[model samples]
Target chain A: MKIRHRDSDSGKIQLEMTPMIDIVFQLLVFFIMTFKVVAVEGDFNIKMPRMSAGGAPSDQLIPPLRVRLTTPQDPNAPVCGIYFGQRQLASFEDLRNEVAATVGGGGPNADADEYEVELDCDFDLPYRFVIDAITAVSGYRDPSSGQIVPLVRKIKFAPPRQASGG
Target chain B: MRYKKADNELLEADLTPMIDMTFQLIAFFMLIINFTEAEQDQRIQLPKSELARPPEQPFEVALTIQLMKDSKTDQELIIYGGEVMPLANLQRVLAREREYLTRTKRSPADATIIIRADGRAKTGVVQQIIETCQEVGFEQFALRAQQEEAG
Candidate 1:
């Protein structure tokens, strides 16, 4: 027996939207949930070509200014004292001020192009302090403009001090 | 009493706007997503610097070295190519990299060695790593840090 209803219009076939919508929502959720916020990273480029035979300090246009970071005798100290040239400094800020003055503002104030810095760090000093020192001598962010004023672009490391045990 | 059939009316809410909005949201998220984080290892807590701005141009050839040092135990380790080993064992890895570069007709001097070391790691260890890279014929180095906003 065949049944026909007077209220039905049966010619059109409707597509199912439920599964597509479900999957779309799932895709959206997956992307959103897996999304991460990563901090911007940067680098300090140091071009230290291998020293030629005979240990020549050759081809240096300007002698590098020495900045030594001294580790405290107590192995537990978090930061190191900075010795910029002959003057022993208390903080990285001091080192920055001294370097800025010595580098002088070239271009308008002085020539930072010919300037260089050689960092001599201790065997056990935390690496962060070295970066702090590098950040200090390399440049300072202008407080008002928030612009980074580069100081010495050329930075090199002195030979590592002897390891305490290993 | 007579009940009316609703199926003949073909009732459907408009879904076009909802789907359009969803696709827009997905596109926005896809645009902002950064895939470079895969190259970074979460184990190393990098040093922060306000002046550490990203380079204006990417290096032509780069090799990343992730260094980790246990503060309490002083056990240093190097993470490269997803492999971790003691710091003293890094020479072997560097040698392999140098060999690979030479075999591929690329010079080690052409590659910039990028060192991403933990903040708590020793400065001497970093220097030692540089020396090892230099010994491997790598002339260029990059010390990486997280960018901190000026305060």
Candidate 2:
């Protein structure tokens, strides 16, 4: 009897995996490049004052007015701030006048458009200061438009940290 | 005349390289992933305001106070930031930190008192922390809370 080897069984299996490997490594590199391990410090747990009443109805994006409260030049003290817009306003009255002028110039339906004035205050600042700031912003109205935008309504308060407490 | 026939035609896929690359990619994501808690494990949510902007300069180290219910006993107050210090001492420590920052001319503004109060933690305790932060020279603060859920 003669011993015979099977030629088909003897051949090595060759799989074309170069492209697959390339993709795998590419994905690896991509993830490595984009991966960020942020050491987020601080405990994020508190009941933030409810901001949205029903969520600003789907249609409204208006210019925002800003009111920032700074630590009185003295760090050991309470907070105070300067209220001014691009147009220099000497007093609270001037701020109101500028707002009225701006709104009046905007023409029809400008009043219907939402006007948001945001108050920026430190967490440490007495809530009273924030309330007071809200009051000031509320007093400004465009008599021509008969629009009375609330002072602090539709407000967004952010944490001083890069990320919000949430 | 007659012709001879071929014995075999074989094809196989090599998976060695592909498997190696997949392992490497998985490793990369494993190393660089940042895991922020999706929900407040402690059930607290933070407020958002537009006025909140990043500090001009990175803040220097200061005492931080974390208020959590004791994980073990559930009765004691667990205050851990740098060390476990009593809330009463918080004001004194902050005032001292303020003077030191001022003496160093580093701007007391750079030091912040991070208050991490559990959602259930009484508002009174949070108020106390606020009072201390105000009494001390520290003006900068970051209130931490879970983000609200998307509706």
Candidate 3:
């Protein structure tokens, strides 16, 4: 007995394009409405000050470098005074130089566990200034690759001080 | 000499080009859409920083906190999940998050917190939020900032 391999009524199998087109249009509308074009975002990783858990004594050799940020007497002053240890910095450039020097110009000493930069800012100081201070001390821009090669990996905040009389 | 009537029924619109254009639009939108916006608050203007760089790897999971301040009063408004909550309530939410992590057998140290604060927001307020997170045992933090425009 010969078996019929094909359908008795042979015709072009039509695909309903209307439903598929409708769904695709729906998806296009959804995406268009929800789309947002934003610049790439980045982060400055910070470790929140935590109480010591009494681990083994650190083998750090270098002492922590301190930075102090003080607001001006005038409430509306745009710039704040930045200090590296006991010496006052003339500008953010000066702060960077001081940090580079303290961290040994991002040399081998910069890799030491004890090499830390602690930021001490008055409570009234704007956060933008503090961020500038962080950026200044965080690293030096490598001229060759134009990348920020981190100088001091360890950073912490000194307990914020109350704003004094302005 | 009689003329034959011509068929006008074959003039249907060609939907193939329309479908192609729609698909192209869909592809463009799909490529540009940022799903992360769900976790970000448009109200917060991130501070720009020269040292800030994009994370090497995206965190598998993170809790986003948005901090805003009243321009006139300087009072902080903490936003979580699109709702404004007091700082005390935020701590409670953190506690609940910690509990959820514990139940999931994940350590708080493994959890990450992202703080998106307005550029003008006070540093002290941001620090307080960080300290609060620290108090709850979260060790990793990502302070979001916009990349400084190069001159």
Off by over 4 Å in 3: A1-19, A52-60, A72-78, A107-114, A163-166, B1-7
Q: Give model 2's TM-score for chain A to 2 decimal places.
A: 0.40
Better of 1 and 3 by TM-score: 1
Candidate number with greatest lDDT: 1
Give me the displacement of residue A26 in model 3, in angstroms: 2.8
Q: Pick the candidate with the highest TM-score.
A: 1
- Residue A35 in candidate 2 has what lDDT? 68
Docking class of 1: medium
lDDT of each: 0.84, 0.48, 0.76
- lDDT by residue for model 2 (A1-166), tens: 9988678876577667678677777777777776654433322112222222113332337745665654345533333554544343344445545554555533454552366664455534433344334434444344566553433233333333221223
Worst 10 residues of 3 chain B by lDDT: B36-45
- Misplaced by over 4 Å in model 2 are A1-166, B1-63, B71-78, B92-96
| Model 1 C-alpha lDDT per residue in residues B50-147, reported as the tens digit of each score | 88878899998899999987657767788887778777788888899899999999999999999999988888888888888888899898999999
lDDT of 3: 0.76
Better of 2 and 3 by DockQ: 3
Query: Using TM-score as the measure, what is the rank order of every candidate, best first?
Result: 1, 3, 2
Looking at model 1 chain B, report the run of 10 residues with the lowest lDDT sum.
Answer: B4-13
